[model samples]
Every structure is written in structure tokens, then in C-alpha cells.
Target: MNTDMTRNDFRTVAREALLAAVQGLVLAIVVLPCGLAFVVLTLVSLAFVPLGIGLLTTPAVLTGVRALADTRRKLAAQWCGIHVPAVYQPLPRGGSPWTRTFVLLRDPQVRRDLLWLPVDMTAGFVTALLPALVVFYPLQGIMLAAGLWRAYVPATGESTWYLFVPVSGQGTAFLAAVLGVAILAVGWRRTPRLLAAHFRLTRAVLGGDAELAERVRVLTETRRDAVDTSAAELRRIERDLHDGAQARLV
Candidate 1:
């Protein structure tokens, strides 16, 4: 029974590690293009400023930026199990385009999202690449151990080491394979944690800090509303009693 439990645990860890590696690769592929588009949109928004076209178009650009940011937030939440909730200020209604644009620009959450663009691109890039790289490096080592390194890089006569010790000759390939196995052993334990750490950083930076405050504000308003409703109900009851029952008693 213990052995069966151990095997199940091992399988679970392996599955999670594989999923994290795939998630990292997907993130790497998607984030780069999204980042580039975000940067381009920002520049275009700026250029439109001089021509006064931004008054008409900047909101759309900003909307795209928000959409991109939202994608990152959603991915982090879904893949990494780190929920980064959004808390955007309500925009004023019935405003001109320019007025709405300025309002969006002035919002704290919008500003934070704008700043998150470059940071997400850079940090998310590293975050997304590291898991895949960590996994790939070990596979490369195994391939080197199989003597395929000779075909890949023909005549580089350098020694490879797991730490500080030298690995040389055909037997050295076996040592490389051993090192690769060791890396896989350790990586299965560490990869998920490392990936979670990266997502935690993302959540902290991109997520709302004012959640508690917002909750408090909402609660306060709700409490007041409830009190007002109760008082209104009591007044209606009193009126009914006075007009019906009290008149009958008199």
C-alpha cells in the first residue's frame, strides 16, 4: 500500500512538472508577440497625439492594452493557480472622446496596467522561458551522453562537468546522462514551485492592492442601504397599524 501511494505521488509530481513545462513554452510563444503589439500600440498612441487623432483612437489602443493585460492575468490564474483580480475605477458616462481618454489616463489602475506592459514582457519572458530551459538543459545533457553532441558540434574538445569535475571520453557521456537524470530528479521537485513563484510575482505587481478597501467601501454602502430599507419597512408597518388597527381600537 505504501509503495502504491508512493508511485501515485511520483506520477502526480511528474504530471504537474510536464504541464508546467508546456505552460512555459506556450507563454514564451504568446507573450513575445503580445508584448510587441503592446509596444507598437503605445507608440502609435503617442504619435496620434501630435495629430490630435489620439482623441479618437487612444481609448481603443488603451482597450487593447487592457485586453492584453487581462490575458496575462487570466493565464496566470488558470495555469499557475494564482488569481490576480482586477479592480478598475468606473469611467464617467456621457463624455466626449477626449474627456473619456483623459479619464482613462488618469485612472490609477489604468496607469498600473500601462506600466505592467513592459514589466510583464520582460519578467514574464524570463518566467516563461526558465521552465522550458530547465527541462531542455537536462535533455541536452542526455543527448550529449548519447554521443550526439559530436554530430551537433563536431570538433569542440572541451570537457563537460556536472559541477567542477571533468567528464571526458565515451564514458563521459554516461556521466552526462547520470547528471541529466539527477537534474530531472531535482527538477520534478522544484519546477512547479519555481513556476508558482514567478506567477506570484506577477499577481503582486499586476493585481489590485485596494481590494480590502474596496470591500470595506462596498460593505459600508450596503450596510447603509440595509439600514435605510429597514427603517422604511418599519415606517410602513407603523402607518398600516395606525390607519387600520389603531383606528379600529379607538
Candidate 2:
């Protein structure tokens, strides 16, 4: 029974790690490129705002930026249970495009979103990619040990590398495999924490102390609600036992 429970625990950990890896890859590949592209578009549009051509276009582009930031906030909450409330200053209704564009430019949340884009594509990109790489890179060395090194060697008859171990022959291949397995064993348990770090990194940029307080406030409210719900449930169950069972006995 103990052995089965241990295996189940490890299985759950492994599954969470794999999901984190995939999430990291998604942030690295799709989110990174889309964010950078949006930034470029926004900058280009801003450059033309003086010409009256970008008055409308800039706000449209900014809408995309807002959407992207909101998506990040949603992911942060869903993936890592971090609550980053959207605190944007609402746009005044019926303003001219010129007025609205500048108003968005002046808003603190909008400014942070713009600032975060560059950071996200760079530091955020690497942080998001590292968990997946750490989990998968060891597999290459293991594959090399399984006779993939011969395929790795070129026609020039040169040796290939696997984690600093040169795979010149079977002996080196075995060494590489040992190193790979060691790494995998060590890092597998930490994969979920690594992805959690990625979300926290973005949260640092997207929301700071205010967001932390908000998250805490939300958690307290949720806990209170849960306690209240449990109390109500207990009372209902007691009433059922009293009215149904005691009435029959009486």
C-alpha cells in the first residue's frame, strides 16, 4: 500500500511537471512572438500619430495590447493561482480619438503593459522556456546512449557532444546516459516550481504589492465563504438526521 501511494504521488508530480513544461513552451513560442509583434505595431502606429493617420489606428493597436495583458493576467491566475486584478482607468465615453489615445497613454496600467511587453519577450521568454528545456534536454543524452550517437556523428568522422561528454564511442555514450539520468532525476521534481516561477516573474512586472494585497484579500474572502458554506451544510445534515431519523423512532 505504501509503495502504491508513493508511485501515485510521483505520478501526480510527473504529470504536473509535464503540464508546466508545455505551458512554458507555449509562453516561449506563441506568446513571445505575438507580444513582440504587437509592440512593434504599436510603436509604428505611435510614430505616425503626429500625421493624424494614427489617431484611430493607435487606439486599435492598443486594444490588442490590452487584450494580451489581460490574457497574461488570466494565465497567471489560472496557472499559478496568482490573482492580478485589472485596474485600468476606464476610458471616458464619447471622447475624440486624439483624446482617447492620449488618455490610454497616460493610464498607469497601460504604461505598465507597454513596459512589460519588452520584458516579457526577453526575460519572460527565457524564464518560460527554461522549464521545458531542463526537462527535455536530458533526453537527448539518454537517446545518444541508446545508439543515437552514431547518427549524430557527421561524415567527417567527428565526435558529437552531449552535456559536455563527447560521444566518440559506446563508453562515452554510457557516461552521457548516466549524466542524463542523474539530471532528470534531480530536476524532475522541481519542474512545477520552475513554471510557477515564470508566472511569478510576469506577476512582478504586471502587478506588484497592490496585486499581492488584492490576492490576499480575495483569499480571505474565499476562505470565509468556504467556512460559512460548511457550517450551513452541517446544520442541514443535522436537521435531516433529527427530523427524519428521530421522527421514525419517536
Residue lDDT tens for model 2, 95-143:
9999999999987778878888998898889888888987888888888
In model 1, which residue pairs have backbone atoms overlapping below 3 Å?
none
Residues 28-146, candidate 1, lDDT per residue (tens digit)? 78888887787888778868876888887888888888888788788777777788877776767888888888888887778878887787688878887777767766886787777
Q: Every model's Cα RMSD, please?
A: 6.4, 15.4
TM-score of 1: 0.77
Q: What is the lDDT of residue 60 in candidate 1?
A: 89
Local error of candidate 1 at residue 102 (angstroms): 1.0
Total clashes in model 1, counting residue pairs 3 or more apart in sequence or in different chains: 0
Candidate 1 displacement at residue 194 in angstroms: 1.8
Runs off by more than 4 Å, candidate 1: 155-172, 212-250
Q: C-alpha displacement of 59 in model 1, angstroms?
A: 1.0
